[model samples]
Target: MTATVHTLQANRAPSLEPMMALTTSGMNAVNAVILDRMQSKVALIPELAGHLIAGGGKRMRPMLTLASAALFDYPGTRHHKLAAAVEFIHTATLLHDDVVDGSGLRRGRRTANIIWGNPSSVLVGDFLFSRAFELMVEDGSLKVLKILSSASAIIAEGEVDQLTAQRRIDTDEDHYLQIIAAKTAALFAAACRIAPVVAEAGEEAEDALDTYGRNLGIAFQLVDDAIDYSSDSATMGKGVGDDFRDGKMTLPVILAYARGTDGDRDFWRSAISGDRVADEDLARAIDLVRSTGALADTLERARIYARRAVDSLGSFPAGKAKSAMIEAAEFAVARAY
Candidate 1:
């Protein structure tokens, strides 16, 4: 049977706004720390960093860090520093991602690489990476240091794995999951996991939050992959079809290729593997993916993970933080709308 296609809908439920509101005070402190730490006498470091930081994308990762800490009633301000570190790592990855993807747009603005040049962007990314470590070291918690450092290594490994899998239509669903798990979910897991560490909330709470973050991260990336095909460049904050143009074999593409007819498979291989794809080719690829039900199935898979993310919070007592975190999972999938 052909793949099942379902109409997509926007999530009208309040998404991240509530979570942001819940953590507003803590996030303000985190933002202050971020602004203070991002400075430099070299001028370009702040210039480049601020270019992306001020571009208006939601600081979801750092928000997760703060909210997770609040979930456990963390007493110290250490999480503020950790939240800043998380943001730095996330922002650094974005800069490098823009360069790697040869992307020209992010958050509806010119990419840092496009305005500042690739070398500058890459070097500044390295600067941010080093700064993240500096912040970690300043916190002076060995456990915290270990958690974030390991996540950084995993994120780098995930990027390399994705590089290896690129343009290879033979890449499967399992491999796609592995790549995103490391690249995207690792940070989310680390950010949440660190909250419990700082609060001395014990291993049980830490594990639950880690599970929550990992599942939410997977769901988040799934929707992001789907949006790349379905949304406009302006709405998505990045080039539409950038993944398709780069031959990145995300879950939707993998599912479509597997479910497609022989001719459909051939078209996917040619469209993705070629040196250059015309606009018409991307249009046809989107149509093929939709008809094969890849988008709907991929999103359905995301919803499952989102539910798992929400379920992970069941162990926590009923509270605003727990509720917000649950909505955060829903937001991850709902963002596709």
Candidate 2:
């Protein structure tokens, strides 16, 4: 397959049209409702949680929570609880990720760890995680609890693996996929899968949503990795080349190092794996990635996952919910850039 797609967003319109419409929908009372529920329920955490959430999120996970609930024609309002639960889980991970990566910025602002200190950020992340369990238990659903619990464990394992594997050039595409699936895709898969149970659907709807979530999660991470190589601080929110300085081996950089000639191999050894990469060497790394066309190739690979993610949404009937789900998948790849 060719390793370039000029416009992934444009191509995704027909399949993910529903999900894309939501990006234009804007943040509104849905958040107000969620915040009210959160205050009444997890009062103290909401103080910190509100700060983390009250910004420009696409609400993709919460959308999955709602879409799945809507798909089964749910009569009750527990899906609201579940949607908040999704955002809480997502937010907690971001807090923890900043601590782990020592990230100073996220979503175009100072990271929670940077503002609150790693200790507070880590503890707040724990509080939110425990809050999720508290909410899940109130639902009294064993299946929902199980799905989320398993996803959490896998996410931890993926993060541990990533920390251990850093600077290890032997790592390949499969390893990268595995780590992203566990660390990033786990909650997404769980969020979609548990939606049917909240609506009390049978096994089939549950299975389809599970599949959709898994593929979408994988696609999201791939695009995230690609963006680290190509995007700027304004579009990405975080520092450009932040991943490189932190010694992250994202798909584009990984591909470039592997396919490059002997000099390129030496460059990776000296710059990426070395103690401290000078400014000149860092710029060289960017050049090598561009010359190797890995950025375009990685972007193209992300496109494949985007297609798979939206295609998984096809099992459901056509409607606003389905369209939103598809567009959300496309947005994962397109993001701001």
What TM-score fits each model? 0.95, 0.86
- Over the stretch 1-337, how does candidate 2's per-residue lDDT look in tens digits? 1122222344333343454344232224346545664463545466656767775666777777766666666667676666666677777888888899898777776777777688878887887777777877877778888988888899889999998778777678888888988998888888888878877777877877887888888877777776666636565667667777777777877899888999888777655675556667667777777889987788788778778867766666665566567667776677725
Model 1 Cα lDDT, one tens digit per residue, 1-337: 1222222245456478768998999989998998899999999999999999988978899999889988888889999999999999999999999899888988778999999999999999999999999999999999999999999999999999999999998999999999999999999999999999999999998999999999999999999999888946555777789899899999989999999999888888887686548898888888877898999999999999998888888777767787788878877887787
Stretches of candidate 1 off by over 4 Å are 1-12, 231-234
lDDT for each of the candidates?
0.89, 0.73
Q: In lDDT terms, how accurate is model 1?
A: 0.89
Off by over 4 Å in 2: 1-47, 274-276
Winning candidate number (lDDT)? 1
TM-score of 1: 0.95
